[model samples]
Target: MSDYSIRLYVDSDYEVTRNLFRNGIIEHHNKAFHHALQRPHIWLPALVVLTLPALNLVSVTTSILVVLTAVAAIWFYCRYMYTSYVDYALSDDMLDISKYYLQRDGFCFWVAETRGGEVVGTIAALPSSDPGGEKHLELKRLSVATKHRGKGIAKVLCRTLIDFARRRGCEAVVLSTSLAQINATKMYEKLGFRQTHSFYPPGLLGQFLDFKIIAYRYDIPAL
Candidate 1:
């Protein structure tokens, strides 16, 4: 892998990470049209996990009625924040991470094609309910650009992130998706991710579950 090197963004990788954050997020919203604009992101996984399920399951219909209201509530009460927590684990020195980043499209799309070169695949991380008692990662998005699909690129990316997270002390990495991207779910399964949970987007569980963590633990040396 001498020719291929994975760049870690932290405070040092701030600028680029920020760019990755901004461009990627905006692109995501434009296309998917989902997320808490104020803070649709899950900054506190455990709190969300606990409070949400504990929230009365409600009449199944009541749950339906609660959807837009919850969306409106979150839109006003939350704000989106980007992170390269893995990057922070990569270095001991304080990093200026806002610069030297990539966020052109969505991160899944961006990293899949950085430097205007061929990008085979992509993975997006988000928050998940912490039933396992640790902050988790959800695959917010995963895509293997059409030209590069069917190759092992997506696996490579996921394996790389798994290794990165292991070294960084992350208990797990997670993500959630719907019919819109069934292939992504399949890829995650190939990589050993079992669905701890699933739901219709904009559903109650959607708010409760943030990151979709895979079941298997991957350990590989980081480059």
Candidate 2:
């Protein structure tokens, strides 16, 4: 038997849930910075900067400082972008889970709690906003506490959402995850979700960084 129980969101879960969302999203900044640095466009410039000292154009210390400054700038930019996303999400449906999800038909948020009654994870399902996919559900806000992961809490939470969708007669369950969420993508695939498409997130920063969001769908088989 599982040690965790999944239940609908309650007013008391606000603070912890928000923190989970913020930290879970922000935690990817480091990975994103690393991924950004791996891009030729980004690293090539740093490489060129590093060669300056060898070319006798700049002192070794000066070259190192310039490269470090560029890396710091990229790190800060990634942090800012993620922070901005979290703020926007908090101001959106996440601002009031009860009002946005609990009260709406076919939209619900759930929290996973341990036997000791500690909230360890969160997941939400909402009607797909895409045209012609009204029967589909979009899973969102799925996050597990760092220390609590690898205990199958995330899988349980996903299964709970999937079961809920199936009972609601939904045609499919879909979710969008970013490249920085490599583990999440792998988990989704393990749960039988197939990649439908991918696109860069909206905004200039996303385009410049070449950050992409992959969409996955799990189609329910006919009963």
Best by lDDT: 2
Q: Runs in model 2 with CA error above 4 Å?
A: none
- List model 2 lDDT by residue over 33-138, tens digit each: 9888888988898888899888899999999999999889889988887899899999998999899999989999999999999998999999999878989999
Residue 186 shift from truth in candidate 2, angstroms:
0.9
How much does candidate 2 score in TM-score?
A: 0.95
lDDT of 2 at 110: 96
Question: What tens-digit string does per-residue lDDT give for candidate 1 at 1-223?
Answer: 2323334333333344334433433333222223333233543432354455457744545554455566554443222211232234224212322221233211221234444443334454433445773545444334444544576666766776675456556666765444224466677777777666554334363354332222322222335
Error of 1 at 181 (Å): 1.7
